[model samples]
Target: MGSTKHDGDVIILTGASSGIGEVTAWELAKRGYRLVLAARRADDLGQLAGAITQRGGLALPVPTDICVEAQLERLVQMTLDHFGRIDVLINNAGVAKAQDAATPTNPHIDMILGTNLIAPMRLTRAVLSHMIPRRSGHIVNVGSVASYISAPGQAVYNASKHGMRAWNDTLRREMKPLGIKVSLVSPGFIRTPMTETVRGMPMVGPETVARIIAKVITHPQREVITPMAYKFLIALTTAFPGPSDAVMSAWRVWKW
Candidate 1:
């Protein structure tokens, strides 16, 4: 897959209206990849597509609530209808809410897991219907450091990301034999609206992650942790759970 040429490749990008997805859309479009943008915000999605088209890039905005199974199907159908083929699927749409796991209502649990975990799984299955037949495509799941380190006050979010990481690893093996590449781009704290209120961590702009996603599409690695430093943190935490637990306790005190 590394040697595969990407000229005029059609990529479906979810959560394109903001954050990493928004920046990634621009990055991929600049690299000459045809894009199908999907998000719940119709106006923002349309504006983004229009902006890309104005700059001589191919973009089709498909407003979709990824949580809805039907909309996920429609998004893929629309992309195939417009572009004739889907070369890449970037599952970037996600949501997080900081609250006590015991206090969260069922809706809260559903929203977090639905958007961050289940939606991607279902969307990937929908896209695979097409990619499997061609035996040529790439699936990039945007995950979080939370997948590895479960911080305080974010239990459900941590669970969602953890599930995502597991899914990505197994899916990569399953798709490998079929010639479809699966990659996970996990990042530490990022300077997006999603993390604006977060503190006590070094943060990078979403563009940094966006560039990595674009590169992964061509180079194709199994998993990539951005900023590189987080890889060491994840290793240390996994090796010494007691210290990680103490730090998480301190974070809980400081946060709440």
Candidate 2:
């Protein structure tokens, strides 16, 4: 779990087409880690892979819809086929919709939970079959501050992230003795294409997250909240839920 040399380590990364995943892929590749990139956008995934290969890094793009169990299985199989082993799995694919809890369509709700929560759990299970026998691997889940702080308009997103946080924590404990490390990297609002329309919140670039992920791969931890300041916010909110809820409610109305 803690190694400085990643010369030929195989890392399977979901959501590798853009944002945090793409950035993290490049960061890991720079550290000499062979990468198996998974994402629904084939063109983008291929392009990213090509770019990495051009830069003299080992990368394989496996276009995948992580929501589908068959696709997730295929992804794991392909990684094993090409790399012959899986060293790490970064579950980064996620989707979100800012809508009232009752107003959002069923498909939207399914998409949010399926991509953010269910898929990661399923994919991790598939990868574990291989990792457990080897007694070595790492699973880093990309979560959000929404997991700890709830906002009115983002009910579904909040739920999905909260579920992810729970899963990550429980899995970390379970994997500790198995020699498989599990970590959760929760970031505040980030400046990604996904958050282009988001406003009035401090945001960090995807590179900041990418670097943290690379570091976590080398030195695993239970959970990390980036920008450091959010740690204080989470502590404050946890201590005073009523005031926090009132502030979030006001912010939701302001956005409206």
Candidate 3:
């Protein structure tokens, strides 16, 4: 009861222009999900929607920037107007990496926090107003292994994921009685466009991660981990803190 469970379900996905988000949207469509795709790149989103339609899937492209509340609200509003209700909202539009004082121009801290942390929370808030009354909905916040095993060179990215993790954990308790499921999916390494930017790491394909995400949403799990091996790694790290910390430190991947 993974993707197939979503047949006829109205789903909203962000970061649909490329990477994991794009592949997830496609995966859900193949499983018969009526989709609403959102991204900052309108052209990319349009092409994506068109591609899905070409494959005989139902989808709509909405230009949106997660950093902005208005755009996010519009995304939620349009989904409701177009599909009448949103059964699932995939918060897959967050940043994966970032900078620190090791460099002079460490990019804009505000932008990192804004896009990676603030936006997803706002989207959750907006979606809940509608979801609560229906008493049935699912929210999947696409996170990373970085959320728990965070490191240096990506401070804000880790913080944002940690925030999402905490928020979802609490929200799970709050919404469980209301019939809304909250899921936080943390994938290890997936070969999306972002994977290319990652330094010195083997990668998993976007389609692979998308499949797991679809599975989690349909089955309503508290957590979904991809590639399988990462689960053992997480357990190992949790068990032997001394060795785990030493290895990550040696690699210069300071756990955050």
lDDT of 2 by residue, 1-256 (tens): 1224678999999999998899988888888899999999999999999999998889999999999999999999999899899999999999877888779888889999999999999999999999999999999999998899888888888899999999999999999999999999999888888888877888889999999999898888888899789999999999999999889877772142
Clashes of 2: 0
Model 2 accuracy (lDDT, Cα): 0.90
Off by over 4 Å in 2: 1-4, 253-256
Q: Which stretches of candidate 3 lie over 4 Å from their true place?
A: 1-5, 101-107, 253-256
Return the TM-score for candidate 2, rounded to 2 decimals. Answer: 0.96
- lDDT on C-alpha atoms for all candidate structures: 0.91, 0.90, 0.83
Considering lDDT, which of the candidate structures 1 and 3 is the better prediction for this target? 1
* Model 3 per-residue lDDT tens digits across residues 19-68: 99998998999989999999999999999899999888999999998888
Q: What is the TM-score of each candidate against the true structure?
A: 0.96, 0.96, 0.91
